[model samples]
Target: MLLFVRTAEAGKYKQSPPDGIEPSTLRLTAARSNQLSYGGTSTFLSIIVQIAQYNLISPLQIPESRILVIGLDDAGKTTLTQRILQHMGQPSKTTIMSTVGLETYEFKDKIAKDKSTYKLFDLGGSGRFRSLWEVYASDATHIIIVIDSTDKGRIFVIRDEIQTMITKIKRANQKILVLANKSDLPNAVTHDKIVNACKFDGVLREFQIRGLNCSALQDTDIEAVVDFVKSK
Candidate 1:
């Protein structure tokens, strides 16, 4: 089975002075104290106090969001997944072979005072693995169904797979992100045609799903896909 894992590198936190504490006071204290002790004691105490204060006002961290990436074979799900990780500055070295079941990756992000985590499952795209998708389908908060935009002839086939997965999961409320991959090619099918062919009206009426054009082969286009995933 081919599985790709991308983990974001941990970011450094710049601890600011506690809300009411003056920077000048901290500087003066540091200046007066011996360099070695000041580095250890003052810094440690300041961090502890700041953390205690932050805890009192901050909300508990939300559990990481779980997402399932699924699509027809050769739809570029693995490549897209790798691109997503890269966009976050966490390029992974894991190479995905043909996935037999599923591959998992964890991502952690700290933006401002809030922390966000995500768990992504890159499910297999082979026909033999279709039966196994149902078992893991319900775990996904969001589903990304990648379609080869250039393979217009197979639109219905992709639609069938998506519908089957949705039916098995039986979660009408789960959000869906339709990635139109291979958009960089001249022969790629237009979004409108693909939607029409896939009979998206039923999905539109029943579920929360949005479509975006992407070319995972190109670095910039992958960023667009990442933004879409983050926005959802």
Candidate 2:
């Protein structure tokens, strides 16, 4: 999620510093961005949530989410997940490597008023592993696709992957978030180009999908994403 932080006055809080205290809007916005647009070379992330009614079970009823993160190898999926982990206060690996078949990460974010638990599936995106996408997505509440913004040659492959995944997704309201990473690169593609190249208009007609430019490390607000999940 590409977030824009509009902080409040620091003079009000004396004890907490900027790093520990965030006063800005935790904007985790994406496709169907009625109020969002390409903020130039700022930060970029796209969210596609197939809105639907949700069924709750546990009494605590914290925001229970099963997020499926899938994309081509080296698309920065692992890195992006790690960044989100930092926001969630989860223990992250110091040395990140390519995921094997699939890696599962579970964390309960206590920062968002002591609610919300996230279970993320980081699946391998190589050719052989792509087949398992539907298998994992079937039970996932949200699906995230990460793409290397500079790789124009492989954009077609991304289109096919998304289209195929969309058809196989079991839940009609499963949401999707596209992280067009490496946007800060000298020759990276903009949010609009990624959407047009992926033919999102044809594939995501059920949604008012929109895009935004943002940095994965500096601009994401995992809390806003959790808020959306809780809304479902």
Candidate 3:
């Protein structure tokens, strides 16, 4: 849960916050909070709390992010999650599980002073569950689309899916973090090739997209992942 607490509320939020957002734009960071309750009794006392006033939520009452970690079934989405967690000193005891429908992992990147916890919604890449991507995309604040860099034949499939997805959603200002996983593999596709093939310049034109080469298993390019996620 992305909770925002202030000494005194300030700042105005948009009438409706976008499902996707850029951390730098909000300067969003989480803070450790403890819920406390106290009671006072008087001759005649009544307590009233103002939850909301004209949707003025102190620039909050907003979601930090619901990041959709999407890719093909074997695109290393699960491995990427575990590997990055290990680097963050939160190793997963259970081995990577093949996502049946969806698996969620919450992450608070360690690279920056930013304290928000990003929920990585690892949607199963199977064809059947691909449709669910749209259902979830509507609520996602950021989309981390993982690509299997070594699978040249299916790279087209991945590209087509991306093109299709972009068309089906409200993509303006959508913040996407594209990770080209398994780049350390033999004859892996180059970053340039992946971008062009994925049509990042075309269909994804309206998105605030950033791409990085990553070998999650080997921990290479891991910092880039941490940094971007914790951006702000």
Global lDDT of each model? 0.59, 0.60, 0.62
Per-residue lDDT tens digits for candidate 1, residues 42-158, read 243321111100111212332346677788788888888887776666656466544444556767643222256776767767776666555455655577888889887777887
**Candidate 3 residue runs with Cα over 4 Å from true position:** 1-63, 89-91, 107-113
What TM-score do all the candidates reach, one by one? Answer: 0.66, 0.66, 0.68
Name the lDDT value of residue 81 in candidate 1: 81
lDDT of 3 by residue, 99-202 (tens): 55555566665644346766656677878667656655655677888888988888878778877777776543667887889889998886678888767777
- Better structure of 1 and 2 per TM-score: 1
Which ranges of candidate 1 are over 4 A from the true structure?
1-63, 94-96, 110-114
Highest TM-score among the candidates is held by which one? 3
Worst 10 residues of 3 by lDDT: 45-54
lDDT of 2 by residue, 65-127 (tens): 877778898887777777667666778877777765556676777455546677777777888
Candidate 1 positional error at 232, Å = 5.0
Best by lDDT: 3
Cα RMSD to the true fold for all candidates = 16.4, 18.0, 11.9
